[model samples]
Target chain A: MTEELNARDKEEVRQEESTHPGRSYRPDVDIFETAESLVLRADVPGVDESSVSVRLDDGVLSLEGRVSVQDYENLTPVATEYPIGNYLRRFQLSNDLDPEGIAARVTDGVLEVTFPKSAQAKPRQVQVTAG
Target chain B: MTRFRFASPFDSAGRLLTLQREVERASGNPFDAEQSPSGRGVFPSTNVFRDDDGLTLRMEVPGVSPADISVEARENTLTVSGERTIQIPEGTSYHRRERGAGRFARALQLPRDVDPTNVTATCKNGILTVRVAKSENAKPRQITVQAA
Candidate 1:
């Protein structure tokens, strides 16, 4: 059997202070590039569409998600392997992407963000003439 | 009297599978599981919670459809199995691929037998929760003292 992939616990974020009262984890993410845009997908279980936030400022993209702690309010843990927490992570975006054209959505607890490439960054076809 | 008997994250079968994977890695297998910076473990890591009524099992299965997952309870064992698929458009080039895909099944031994008919499951925002009610015969009972 192949080894299964496990979720990683993100260490404390020392750079910024969080307004939320719980731990902030770095959600697992996959990034890829298509012809028109750069796509990113992150696993943020427990977070719905309204609880997720995506912002780009000064070439840095930030992702944050808050999980509803109310779900486990009265339940006591019998055997625990993974902890519940909010999600936080950031990425540096190159100038080739157009910040205004970015689009994001959340489904099945996976957040997908598509950053469209700037007009100048797209490939241009040059006309070849007979010499 | 022991009130609870908790099962460790890795049961006998789980340990054996881990050992086999380790041996394969030592033998220079190319399809080696992607060694994440945080290392590897079972998929859809699970958490078990208990209350007066029953036990609840929660698993993280982002991007997985509810129809793809299955839960079964037999005797005192609870088994969760499912497949996760990630779709990528054609001609896409990956810069970072950390999410792993495929079929995963985990069997967990419960502290007591559960009523098969009383079990229920639900999925929301990629989290799957299975609630198994304790068997009628196993539930805790209170005995009242009669006036002497």
Candidate 2:
């Protein structure tokens, strides 16, 4: 009975490790800040444009997607280090972000998120009045 | 070796021998193909360019998000790694499958000496572009001559 319990515990641990490898679902991100907007780029291989979802709930930005590996049945896979699971990521947005105008798109496995800065956050030119 | 012979009509034991041979050759390794199973573990095709200002590296990685990629530079090498996942819908049968999954890693050696501290990466559309500024020693210098 003890041996069986130990075997089951090992299997559970393996399954947990495979599902959540403790790494970021999206491993790479590039952030670019410009005069008017901030652009974010992420690498999400094996996913399609349609499979990606981007949402802003409250002040948090979340990105989600899925990658399926149903193909290549004929060629046996000798080894794989990648864990398959639902990709998830979240970011806290600053007050300068214009959430209403934020835009996102995915192409060729890369996702780009553009956040336009609010008018109040942009630099303003102050005029001087001569006395 | 065992041999069999066919005899003439009048004399059944008279002989003409027959021989047979079989040849087998192993198939080519699948890794040579552009889209092999293992190939999915690395980033797709990429292009690198160098100019007076900096170096640019572009990789084709579709369907990924900005949060999914990671880039790190150590010594003279830059490493890019990421993961992509897909789920098959229930009741769907796949006729053909080509894309690969899991974690992928790609490392590149810069053509010119770069200031690792000033490296930047940008992704637009489906291309991941990494720009690294060249070190003073690696940048081109123009020399002027003064006539005496």
Candidate 3:
């Protein structure tokens, strides 16, 4: 059962070619919407803070991560189950989300991006006056 | 028996040992192939690397806390077990859920017996690296020759 579960979620890099050389994988992300913001968490193993870049441009959120090649230097693999590569993914954000309010940080190779909803986009209680 | 043991300055036994080590490394140690076979896309995909001195086992375990990970090396087997928990806050709706969360344990049989006391493991940037040194007998030795 564990093997089945793991086999299903293991995502392979698509054939879409990038301008850059080498391989790039689409990171697995969990996106959830809270009352105030939409949170996105992506798994990007082998990348540190300096190598990860998150950008919000023209309502498009882009994530790029580069794995440190020095880690594998001078080491020959006897057996390899996973391919080492960089990570790239993009998402189109809705206008309701404030681009300036987006906050992102990476810890333990997991990148967390929080997009706060615009003030007008949020649900609010309307005051009623007795006529 | 003497001829078999000392066929030449370099005996067949040493060559056989080198060949065996090469085959074991290339084929991922068939002696324990049934245990945690690779290429099936298992969780925390592991890769074994070799150098002159020892072997290095690396596993991708992003988002797993160091406290939750446990690594054990005994004899010629290495066991790595860990738990991954995803905390979903209350009153939240998931738009897309792709990440998996659970506990996983994988055991791998090394090609050669390793020095258990020399094993060292470290988790960095969600990647776990374990270094296992080959035992004294397993490491290649250089013998000195003297004139009679």
Candidate 4:
């Protein structure tokens, strides 16, 4: 069952990749899980909350962040150590997550997304009865 | 062995960058006393660029506040140190934590003798751009072409 779900998500991700032809860089992401929620953090420098957009549709979470500008009219970039481009990445959500409950925030160029787990999906401690 | 190392296609660009910097250092020119980026536990990647003015060091430190960061320059070494404080909500817990938490400090050598007083830094978006003006001799000045 897990494999089936993952494969489906992978297909969606592949579709997402081919759809965008413009230059897009993948933001480095960190994902951690707790008992009740899953947290995702992406390193997106040169982007603020206004330029970042998060969307969830049918278990596919798409994260897109655009850099306001890469070149300047007067200042010539003699040497560029880093590449400037938009960021795009798509993630597949499983049934265990509540897609409708997903929330995100951008702080200091870092985008954090929180996904709350469904009640039935959360980890629970089973009580023991002693006779 | 080298060919096998690049089997994974995920981070080929990053690996290529390191290799390019290494090649430049191997050439070993007078100006090549490279003050390269020594990324040691630095949150985001770093880049050091040199121009006629002096040098510019950029570090991608997302989520790190300007107040928490400190920079010190002595001789030719420029050290940038900072920490990103992790704030977990009161009633919430993290399931997956990919972004590193806690404090991190990274220091690197500078390419030229910079004017300490002239150094300026600005944090935009999440990138910290540091400009170190070159010393008097290092600054570009063209001598008058005498008509012989």
Candidate 5:
């Protein structure tokens, strides 16, 4: 079973993080695999549907989300923790996936990308002849 | 008012989650659980920014409805709190769970007093934004320069 994909150590992502020009962050993602599809759920707070961009090139899936924090001219900051930035992540895919069938949607700050398996990869039950 | 909690033998996993949660919760300010306004922890990572107009605080609390979140502004302290419960599909099993869920709160003491009556807050796409107007006295004013 390829269940090891779900147990991927977060440190691996950290190590894979490449230096980007602007302020970008690696969002937390959850991957679930079923018989027919592989689903990726990424948490990218402050980003809405219009600002998110998804691209697949050369077997690599890239998700980029740009979030602009609202500003209040009259207010001043007393404390800060997280800073506003973009969320970017890339994943390498195998040929078992049908890139043409991938679907994505962003809702309530979570982005879901579903990759359907190729027709040949799905399990099939063969018919037997009656004796 | 006080309450007591006892550990269950089979709840080791739950206990471990709680222990790890405590480490992050302590850095952020603490508050009472029932709809308490913001906590100081980084659980719901937040950003505090202010301009000449007012101050805005943004927090990441995905999957949480606006009704589940509560915000309170008093004097110089602003608190944000909410509960985010994980709703797992009945037939589906979770092979991995990295997202943190539960009731959380954090309170921040701003640099200046804010007008609680004029404050506004909105939650969309799992992010919470609060805009607080500074008190009249706390606002910056231009002083007349005498010609010397």
Candidate 6:
């Protein structure tokens, strides 16, 4: 089990290294799973719905886009803390995702991705009959 | 009627010019009337990801249609620009306007090298997603090391 976990972790690191080279800007993402679908919410500041993109291909979910900083250009800088850059993040989706039926939307800088679980992947309530 | 005057020497017009100068000084970019027309009071945001096969970009922009958005890729920069016009209901005064309106433009520097000609974008559910296929040189190639 430990070996498997380590292998998975290594694969994740390799995946991340391959996608984003230097800058690491991982948007905050929350994932919730229901009986029918798995929903993912990502918080991307300074991004409009028109500029974001979400896609899934061959079990790999790729998200790429930029965050516009139009208003910050005029404000006087008091202190700098927030790491500002184009937002880029990736997730290696499991086989449970229904790639064809996945849906996504962005509202108020919040991106919501809904992945309906495959019929076989969903938990089944078995009915027991008298034997 | 008599008016009380402050000690400041500049009039309202002068004060406005001073404020504009201050703003320009604070911001590295000079304030241009042309740029102002393109600029809206909204922030730009984008999401990026990649799987084993391809890369995807999801941008958040509400109240924009596919026809209104324009995406162009030149060299290393990918520009996404559009205008979002929200028509407030008649006779309704907005007490609090949080979401921004008007025109917005955002450009992203893709992390990985891609085939500029093959990039595709789709707008659905108010989210614009641009997918760029990794070029043959950029994609990971497996090295078969034969035992020497």
What lDDT does the true structure give each of the candidates? 0.75, 0.54, 0.75, 0.63, 0.64, 0.56
Evaluated at residue B67, the lDDT of candidate 4 is 87
TM-score of chain B of each: 0.65, 0.61, 0.70, 0.64, 0.63, 0.62
Cα displacement (angstroms), candidate 1, residue B76, comes to 1.7
**lDDT per residue, candidate 4, A84-127, as tens digits?**
55678888877899887889988888899988999999878899
Across A1-131, the per-residue lDDT of candidate 5 in tens digits comes to: 11111111122134446333334567777776677887787878778889888899999999987664333223344444544456788988878999999999887888888889899987789999898
Question: Which regions in candidate 2 have their CA more than 4 angstroms from the true location?
Answer: A1-24, A72-75, B1-148
Tens digit of lDDT per residue, candidate 3, span B1-148?
Answer: 4653435524333443343344345544322334554545566677778787788887889888888899886766777888888887799999999888888877777765567668899998889999988789887779998898
Specify the highest-DockQ model's number.
1
TM-score of each: 0.79, 0.41, 0.82, 0.63, 0.67, 0.39
What shift in Å separates residue B116 of candidate 6 from its native position after superposition? Answer: 49
| Residue B45, model 5: Cα distance from true site in angstroms | 1.9
True contacts kept of 1: 0.58
- Candidate 1: the clashing residue pairs are none
- Residue-level lDDT for A126 in candidate 2: 88
**Ranking of models by DockQ:** 1, 3, 4, 5, 2, 6
Between prediction 3 and prediction 6, the one with superior DockQ is: 3
Candidate 5: TM-score, chain B only? 0.63
* Candidate 2: tens digits of C-alpha lDDT, residues B32-94: 123434443245344454556666665555554557888888867778777655444344333
Q: Is candidate 4 or candidate 6 better by TM-score?
A: 4
Docking class of 2: incorrect
Q: Which stretches of candidate 6 lie over 4 Å from their true place?
A: A1-24, A74-76, B1-148
Candidate 1 C-alpha lDDT tens digits along A3-110: 444545435455766665545678888999988899999989999999899999999999998876557756666556566677898999889999999999999999
Tens-place lDDT digits, model 6, residues B23-99: 33433221212333433322334445454545566555545567888999887677877776544434433323333
| CAPRI quality level assigned to candidate 3 from its DockQ score | acceptable
Q: Chain B, model 4, TM-score against the native? A: 0.64
- Model 4 bad stretches (over 4 Å): A1-23, A32-38, A68-84, A96-102, A115-131, B1-44, B50-52, B90-94, B142-148
